[model samples]
Target chain A: MNEATIQVQKLTKRFGDFTAVNNISFEVSTGEVFGFLGANGAGKTTAIRMLCGLSKPTSGWGRVAGFDITREPEMIKKNIGYMSQKFSLYDDLKVWENIRLFAGIYGVPHHTIATKTDEMLQRLGFASEKNSLVKSLPMGWKQKLAFSVAIFHKPKIVFLDEPTGGVDPLTRRQFWELIYEAATQGITVFVTTHYMDEAEYCNRVSIMVDGRIDAIGTPKQLKQQFESESIDEVFRKLARRATRKEV
Target chain B: MLVFLIEKEFKQIIRHSFIPKLLIVFPVMVMLVFPWAATMEIKNISINITDLDHSTLSKKLVQKISASNYFRLTGLSSSHADAIEEIEFGNADILLEIKSGFEKQLIREGATNVSISSNAVNGAKGGLGAAYLSGILQEYTMEQLAILGIKPVPVIKTTESYLFNPMLNYKIFIIPAIITMLLTMLCGFLPALNIVGEKEAGTMEQINVTPVPKFSFILAKLIPYWIIGVIALSLCFALANLFYGLTPSGSISTIYIFAAIFLLVVSGLGLIISNYSSTLQQAMFVMFFFMMIMILISGLFTPVSSMPKWAQLITMINPLKYFIQVMRAVYLKGSGMGELTVQMVALIFFAVGANIWAVISYRKTTH
Candidate 1:
C-alpha cells in the first residue's frame, strides 16, 4: 500500500486535568479529502491543531509527509499549510501584499511567487480584487482567497479549520471547489466543518463526539450504517450516543 | 444636565480596568520611579587614590576623601600614571594624588597643595568632585591657622569661577534627563499599542500561522518606531542646542551612538510588553507601568545618592540612570567614548536582555 500522507497512532491531547482529544487513530491516503466533523468545542479544532504542528498532543504520535511531528516540527511546518476558522487575514494590508508576505514566509522562490500569485488570483477570479484591502472583501470571497493562499506554497498537506465557518452556502460551495482542486493536484486536504451537508463532499469523514471519535466512514456508508438517509441524522445519532456515555 | 452627562461618561470610563490604572496607578508609579532614577549625582564615584607617602596625615587625608559622599575609593594604585589609566579605562572617576612629606609642610610652610585630578568627562560631576576636594583643603587650612593664632600667610586671597552652567541650574541639567525619559515613552509605548491593536483585531494570530520568522515579524513592527525614536532624539537634541544652548561638547557620533543604544533598549521593552499582553488596553497598561517606573527611577528629579541605600541599588539596574549619565557626559562634559563606555555597556545589556526576553515570551502559536 502507498504510504499515508498523514498517519496518526492513538493521538490524544490533554489540557491540564481536561482531555481535549482522546486516544484516536486515523490515516489519510495521499491526495484525499478528509473531513473532521464535530460541533463547537468537540475537539475538532484541537485535533486539527495537532495535525498542523501548532499544538502538541499529550500522548500518541503523528507523522505528516513522513516527518515525525515531535522530532521535526519545522519540517512538518514546511510541508503543510494551515488556514484558521478566524477568517485569518491581515485586514490592514492589500490582498496582493498579503499574498506576497505569505509566499515569502513559506520560502517560495521569489520569481515563482510573483508568477504564481498572478496565476492563483486569475484562477480564483480575484484578479480585479488584488489591490483591494482584505477587510473590504466580502466574507465569502475572503475565506475562499484565504484558503487559496494557505496552499500557495504547494504543500504535501493542507489543514483547513472551519475554512467556511461564517460564509453563505454559495461561497462555501465555491470554497469546497477550491479544496477539491487542491486535492486533485495530489495535495491531501484535511478540513473541519460544522456543516453536515459539507461532509458529503469529503472522501471520508470522522465525527468527533466530545474528545473521542464516535464514528468514522465514507459519508454514504456512515449514513447507511446508522439507518439514516442524511449525514445530519447520522451526526445526531452519534451525538446522542456521546451524551448518553457522559451520563 | 452637563453634570449628569459627565457622570455617565465617568461611569463608562471607570468600568474599564485600564483607565484607572493608566490615570491613577501609573502616574504614582512613574512619580516613584522618577525620583529614584533622575539623578546625575556621582554616588559611589569610584576613585583610585595614589598616596606616595604612608604618613599619618596622608592616611587621614585618604580617610577624609573616601568618607565623603562624592567618591568611593575603588582601588589603591602604585603610581600616579596608573591612577590616570584607571580614569581612562573607566574603572575610576577621580584620582587623588598625595605628595610625600605633606604633613611636615603644612605646619612649617603653612600652605600645602594637594593635587586632585578628576575624570571630568562628565564635566559637572568631575568639577563637583574637584570642588569638594578643594573645599576640604581650604577648611583644613583655616583650622590650622586658628590653632596657630595666625591669619592668611602673605595675605593671599582665593577666588572661584565657573564658565558654562554657572548657576548650575538643575532645570537645564534635567532637560537631557527629560529627553531620555520621553524616549522610553515614545519607543516603548507606541509600538506596544500597535502590537496590541493587531492582537485585538485578531490579525496577530493570522500572521503567526504564516511561515514568517518571528524575529523578522518583530523587526518589521519595531522599524517604524526605531525611526521615530531617532527623529525624536534629533528634535530633542535640536531643542537642547537651540533653547538651552546645550550642544554636546563631545563627538556628535558618540551622542548618536548612545541614543541608538538607548532606543534599542526601549524598543525591546515595548516588544516584551506587547508579547505578554493579550489586548491593546492591556498593552497600554503594561507600557504605562514601565513608563512611570523607568522615568521615576531614572534619577531625573532626585539625586540617586540621596535615596535610601536600597533605592540606590535599584537605580544601578535602571537603564535610564546610565543613559542620563551618558547624555550629560557627552553634551555637557564633551566626553569621549572612552569616558562613557561603562554606561554604554549597561545600555547594551538592557537592549540584549530585553530582546531575548521578548523573543522567548512571544508564543509561536495561533491556538
Candidate 2:
C-alpha cells in the first residue's frame, strides 16, 4: 500500500554462459525491513549488486531511491548506504575519524559532522572510546560501529550484505535493534542473510532458489503456505528444490 | 570530500609502525652508504714488475708506477715468468716487464719497446690499470729525453681538463641518481600497494559504494604520496649536504619542477598497477617486476649508451632514465630548463600518459 522504495521487473545478470540472477522481480516500501534469503550461490549477492548499482544487469529494469539502476547509478549511490560482509571500517583510524570520513564522503554537512559524530558515539555508549582506534574495539562493537557509520550520512536506504555475519546471537539481536531504529526513522532496510531466525525479524521475506524467487511473503504467511510450523521449515522446504549447490 | 580521503590516507601512513620510520631511515641509509659502495671508479690495481734490464731507468719506472695512486707495486721479480705467475695466482692484476738494455737502447736508438701485460678478467680494472701504467711510462720517456738533451722531432702535447666534475668524484654523479631512486621507490611502490591493500582489507568495496567521484578517489590516493615524495627529496638533499658536502649546481627550483612531473609519472604507474591487481601479493609482485626492469634499464648503475641497441630503445620509454638525466644535469652540470627541455618534455609526456591511463583503468563498478 505504501510507496515502493525499490522496484524491479525481470532484472537479470548473466556471466558468459551462466545466468547469475534470472528474471527476479521484487518491491519493498519505504521503512520496511526486507529480508532477501538464499543459499550461498543462489544469486542473492548478484541481484543485490545490480539493485545497488554496483553491477549492471544484463536485461530488464530496476529502480532504487527514485533513480533508474541503469542510467542513474551515481544518483542511486548518493541516496544509499552500504555495509558489506567484511569489516569496512579503517582499523588504524580512530572511531570518530572513521565516522567523520564516511560523513564527509556521504556529503553530510561539514559543520554538523562533529555534533553528529559525538551524538552517535554517545548513543552507542562509545563516547569514551571515540578516540580509540577501530582495530582496538571488540568484534561485536566493530560491527555495530560499521553499521552506524554506514548510516551516518542518513541515506534513504541502507543495504546490509550479511551485516551481522560471524557475530554471536546476542550481539546480532542488538544489531537488529539498531536496524529497527533506522526503519522507524523512515530508512528502508534491504538485507541479505544466512540465518533463518534473522529472516523472521523482517516485515516480509523473499526465498530465492537457483537464481529465482521461489516464494515471497510475510513470515507467518510463508509458514502457513508451506504448511510448516516455523519460518525455518518454510526456508528449508523452498531451499530443497534448489538445483545449484553452494559455491 | 577529497580532503577526507587524503586525511584518511595520511593517517594510515603515519600510524603504520614501520612506514613512517622507513620513510626517514630508508633515505638516510641509502644516501649514507650507497654512494661509497656504488662507485665505478677503479683504484689500487696490483702490479708485479720484472726488471730484466736492472738499469737506473728501469728501476725508476718501477718506483714511479708504485708511487702513483692507481697501481701498487706488489713485488719485483728477476724474470717475466715469475711476474706472470703472480698474475695467474690472482695476487696481481698487471705485470710490467722492462726488457734488457732499456736505458742503453733509449739513448742509442732513441726508442725501445717495453712490454705490459694485464689479466683482463675484470675488464674495467685491468684495462684502466694498463692505461695508467702507459701514461706513467710516457712521462718517464719525455723526461729522459729532456735530461739527456737528445732533441727529437716536434712532439704534439695534449692537456686534458675535466668539466662539471673536475676531480671526477663519483659521488657527485651517483648521489643525484640515488635521490631519483628514492623518489621512485617511495612514490612508486606505496601507491601501487595502497589500493590493493584496501581491496585485501575489503574497504575498497565500501568506498566504491559511496558517491565519491572516481577522480577524487584517485587524486586522494596520489596527493599524499606526492607530498611524501617531496619531503623525501628534501631529506635526501639535506643529508647529501651534511654527509657529502654536496649541493645541486643548478637552480633547486628546476629540480623540483622536473621532480614534480616525475613523481606523477611513477605514482600514476603505481596506480595503474594497483587498478589491475586484485590482491596485495599480486600487486607487489607486479610492481617488483616492473621496478627491477625499470631501475636496471634506466641507466642507474650503468651508462645507457653502453647497452645494446634494442635495450637502449627500451630506455626511451623508461621514465626513470629521463628523470635520472634531469637529476644528474641539474645536480652536477648546473643545467636549467633550457638545457633539459627534451627530458622535461619526456617526463611530462609520461606523467600525462601514465596518470590518464591510471584514471581510465580504475573501475568504480564491477563488470
Candidate 3:
C-alpha cells in the first residue's frame, strides 16, 4: 500500500462524563478518498476536530501528515487544509481577494500570488466573477469556491467536514469531480458526510455508531461482509444498534 | 501572513455597508451635538418670591433677583404659602419669603433675616440658585447701610478668579471628555464585535485550522481598529476646532501619545471580551455593561472627587478614568507629560495588563 497519510490508535475525546469519541482507530493511505460517516451525534466531528489539530484528545494519540497530533498540532496545521461544515469564506471579500488572502496565509510566495490567483480563478471558471463578493454567488458556487480555496495551498492532506451539505445532487457530483481531481494530484481527502450515496464514492469508508467504528472497509467488502446488496443497507444494519440519540 | 490578515480586516470594514459611513458620521454628530446637550453648567432657574413687606429694601431685593441672568421670577405671590405652591407644582426651583418687618427691622437693628427655600431635587441647580440670591441680598444691604450714613464693621473681602477656564465655559470642559468617550466606544466595541462576528460567521473556526499563529491573528485584528481609533480622534479634534474654536492647549503629539496608549487599553479589553464570548449578542451585552460602568464612573459627566470613597476606588482601576483625566488635563490645562506622569503610568499599566490578558486568553486550540 502507499505510505499512510493518517495513522491513529485508540484515539479518544471525552467531555466531562460523556465520551464524544471513543477508543477508535483507523488509517488512510496517501491519495485515498476516506469517507468518515456517522449519525448526527456520532462523534465524527469530534474525531475530525482532533485530527485537524483544532482540539486535543483526552487520551491516546494520532498523527496526521506524519506529525504527532498533540505535540505537533501547529506542524499538522501547516501540512493540512480544512473546509468546515458551515460556509467559512469571508462573504464581503471579492473572489480574487479571497483567493489571495488564503494563498497569502498559507505562505504562498508573494511575487507569484497575483499570477497564481489569476490562474486559479480562470481554472475555476470564476475569472468573470473575480471582482464579485463571495456572498453574491449561489450556494453551489460558494461551496465549490470554498473547496478550491481549501486546497489552494497544496497541502498533503485536506480534511473536509460536510463540504457538500445543503447542495443539490448536480452540485455534489461536480464537487466530487473536484475531490477526485485533488486525489489524482496526490492530496489525501478525509471527508465526513450524511449522504450515503456519496459514501459509495470513497475508496475506503468507515461507519461510526455511538462514537465507535462499527464498520470500516471498501464499499464492496462492507456490503459483502454485512450480507447486504448495497453499502446503504450495511450502514443501516450497523447504525441501528446505536443507543445514542441524534443531537 | 499578518499583512494579509490586516488587509482582510480593512477590506471587511470598508465593505461593510453601515460601518464606513458610521465612522465618519458618528464622530461628526457627537462633536456637533453632545457639547451643547451634555454641558454641566446650570442656567435659567425659575424662582418664586413672596414679598410681604412692600418696602424699598424688599422691592430692591426682588429687582436684583429678577435682573440676574441665573434666575427668572416666575411668580410673585403675597403669601409664602402661595409661593411654596409654585415649587410644589414644579414651576419654580426656589422660593424666597420676605417678612412684613424686614425693612423696618433692618433699619432699627441693622440686621434682618429673610427665609429661603429651594427644591433640591435637582440639587446643583437649586443650591446654586439660592447662593446667587444670597449674594444679591448682601450687596443690597451694604448699599442700604451706606445710604443711611451708618458705618458698618469692616469685613474681609474675598477675590475669586477661575483658573484654566476663566469664563468657565462648560463646552471647553466637556469636549475633550466627550472625545475620550467616543474613542472608548468606537475602539472598544468594534474589535469585540469584529472577532465575535467572525465566530458567528464561522470564519474564526476556519482561521483556527490554518497555521496562523494566535499572536499574529490577534495583532491583525487589533491593528486595524487602532488605526481607526486614531483617525476618529483626529476627526473629533478637527470638528471641535472648526465649530467651537477649541484646540488642545498642550502639544498635539502629547494628546496623540496618550490617545494611542488609551486605544491599546480599550481595544485590548475588547479582545478579551471577544475571546470569551461566542456570539455577537453575548459580546455586545458584556461590552455594554462594562462601558456603562466605565463611562459613568470615569468622571465623564460627573466629578470623580464628588463620588463616594468606594466608587472613587473603583475608578482607580478604570482605564477610562485615567484617559479622560489625561485628555482634560492636556486640552484644558495645557498639562504636559511632566504634569501627567501618574495618569500616564496608570494607563500604561492598564494597556500592558489588558493586552497580556487578551493574548493569554485567546487559545488556538480548544481543550
List ranges where model 2 is wrong by over 4 Å.
B51-56, B74-89, B100-104, B144-154, B305-312
Q: Write down the TM-score of model 1's second chain.
A: 0.57
List candidate 3 stretches off by more than 4 Å: none
The residue-by-residue lDDT of candidate 2 on A1-247, one tens digit each, is 7899999999989999998899999899998999999888999889988888889999999999999998888899999999888898899999999999999999999999999999998999889999999999999999999999988988999999988889999999999999999999889999999899999999999999989999998998999999998888988988889888789
**Candidate 2 global CA lDDT score:** 0.91
> lDDT per residue, candidate 1, B116-226, as tens digits?
898888888788877777877676677766776666666466776765567765545776677777677767886677666767776666555555566666666655567
Candidate 2 root-mean-square deviation in Å = 2.3
Instruction: Name the lDDT value of residue A223 in candidate 2.
Output: 91
Model 3, C-alpha of A86: deviation from truth (Å):
0.6
lDDT of 3 at A213: 92
lDDT of 3 by residue, B102-165 (tens): 9998888887899999999998888888898888888888888888876665878999999998
TM-scores for every predicted model: 0.72, 0.94, 0.97
**i-RMSD values for every candidate model:** 13.3, 0.8, 0.6
Please tell me which predicted candidate would have the highest DockQ against the true structure: 3
Model 3 TM-score? 0.97
Candidate 3 chain A weakest lDDT stretch, 10 residues:
A116-125
Report the C-alpha displacement of residue B105, candidate 1, in angstroms: 47
